[model samples]
Target: MTQNCFDDGDEDDVPEWADRVMADVAREVRRRRKEMKWSAQDLADRCEAIGFPIPRNVIANMESGRRAVLPLVEVMVLAEALYTHPIRLIYPVGYVEEVQQLPLTYPVDTAQAMSWFAGLNEDFRADHRMLRHHVAHRTAVERAFFAVHSEERQRRAAESTVDDIEQAKALRTQADLAERTARAKAELYQVRSDIYADGDPLPDLPDELVDVDPPEGYERDTD
Candidate 1:
């Protein structure tokens, strides 16, 4: 006889806190899936595609709280299918605050950390994107300059002379500067991302948190 995937056999052993968390996770999963206009079957198919293999009925059970045990793997796959981070599903605002005083382990969870970052206020998110754009631009410039520098170095080496050595040295210095600049920009963005994601208090913003278009000629290159 085949056992039910939803029946983990320890349903009665789940704590009230865990039950509440699962309920919240269920609501979030259902909400996000609906927001994406995906049916439960669609979600199940997606989970299966990602190798988690949750059945449609299992998803329904999860969303309806008929299933008490929600594995982390399933939550992750579901979150991916719903185009969100697992933290959103597992650690909604209320849940986080409720568990804040407890010795919960979510604070150290990387996925939760990323979800928190992704859920930061508009201003921080905007600033992060801008910093990311700057980093990308600098990195692209560095790569292009490095390629040219490599070619120049090879050509100069073939000539077997030190005539252009100073110029090559200057180019190398510029490349190093560009790399440092990119690293600094990336570090700044990461710091902000981590701070906001960790729910630390942020200072007042210089401006309102409205969404602004990327600066001219420096559009975000997510790729």
Candidate 2:
């Protein structure tokens, strides 16, 4: 329910709150544009290159705080134009330590809000299924991708730096150990992902994981 203000006869706070949020966004957009040496026209051109075609006048209005409400699509295109993640513009994480999560709500830590927005953690009031979904998918993604990707990099580094035989051998051994750990995690991720993939034998995985099958007859002893 909107509380009516006594003097102005305003019944809604959302418009004011929304304008404040957009002011923050405008400040950020202008800062990023200036940092990258882009004028309003340049920023607009980048948006056009991204196929959204936000006109220079629109960019001017947004950056000048004349526009308060931006569509979600504009947020995405602006982030890409500025070479930033959408969430960074959505919530100014480093610029402010806390943010009002919503109008009339107490401020929460920016990191907490970011994590909640990213589906990295559960809200107490969130649906139980979604909570489980985030956890399971996050675990599966990390297990299926992280170690294997790191080890692959290490292996490539080892291959390229073969000038020192002993050093190269040490790096390869480290990579082999990491690969063993990756195999264990990938097997577990497959089990956990069945609920998502409806028991498909080959659950969807990152391309790197697809190419990272354990060598045949290679025992995976982590000891």
Candidate 3:
């Protein structure tokens, strides 16, 4: 005979793995609080300053895992109160080597797990081309931005130095930094072009760099 779906009575229940993950979160919160040398009351007060006002008793219960559910709002507020990224609180990178990501799955490497959570890592990146392109494109953008910014500061230092020897050194370094900046910007352009070819939304290039294309003779870094 066919069975009614509701007769099973398990469909509406929260999974056992969810509670385990919640307990992990609770433990991490307590660890961070202790590391900061703050009582539950102190954490509550900090939350109040941020206008979210989690009570001391509530925080204590949460840390004790008596609060079975943690709202995303509270996660964000607690992260702010603890002066850390929400990702770090959830994944505890550098504090743990692996994380149980799902009910039946084996633990995943902590760093890779965190990257997956952030949509920046995938087990089969080659099969998901946009995500792969995004990772490369993002790294190139950051490198180009920092290279240009560094060259700006170096140029300023070269112009302002009163000592002749220091000024010469600054100018030499600025010239080298400028070459690196050009190379980085060149790479960013090529990555961006590849992203566009893949039909993804155009990367949000910095306004100052929107017009800079790859230099005519420079080979873009493939990796």
Compared with the true structure, all predictions reach lDDT values of: 0.59, 0.69, 0.79
For 1-223, candidate 2 gives per-residue lDDT tens digits of: 1122222334455576576567667777888999999999999999999999999999899988777578888989999999998888867777766665566655677778778777766454265554565556567667656666666777777767757986678696866869676675766454444443443233355675554333451333233
Give the residue spans of candidate 1 off by over 4 A: 1-14, 94-223
Prediction 3 global C-alpha lDDT:
0.79
| Ten contiguous residues minimizing lDDT sum, candidate 1 | 205-214
TM-score for each prediction? Answer: 0.43, 0.66, 0.73
TM-score winner between candidates 1 and 3: 3
Every model's Cα RMSD, please? 17.0, 7.3, 7.7
Instruction: List candidate 3 stretches off by more than 4 Å.
Output: 1-14, 93-99, 106-124, 161-169, 213-223
Residue pairs in clash, model 3: none
What clash pairs does model 2 have? none
Q: Model 1, 1-223: lDDT tens per residue?
A: 1111222344443365466667768987887788789999999999888887899999999989899698988888888888878777766654334331122232233343444556554566566755544444445445544544555565555456455876676666656665654554444444444434444432221221111112331223233
What's the best-to-worst order under TM-score? 3, 2, 1
lDDT of 3 by residue, 1-107 (tens): 11111212343323655765676677788999999999999999999999999999999999887887888899899999999988887888777667656555556
Clashes of each: 0, 0, 0
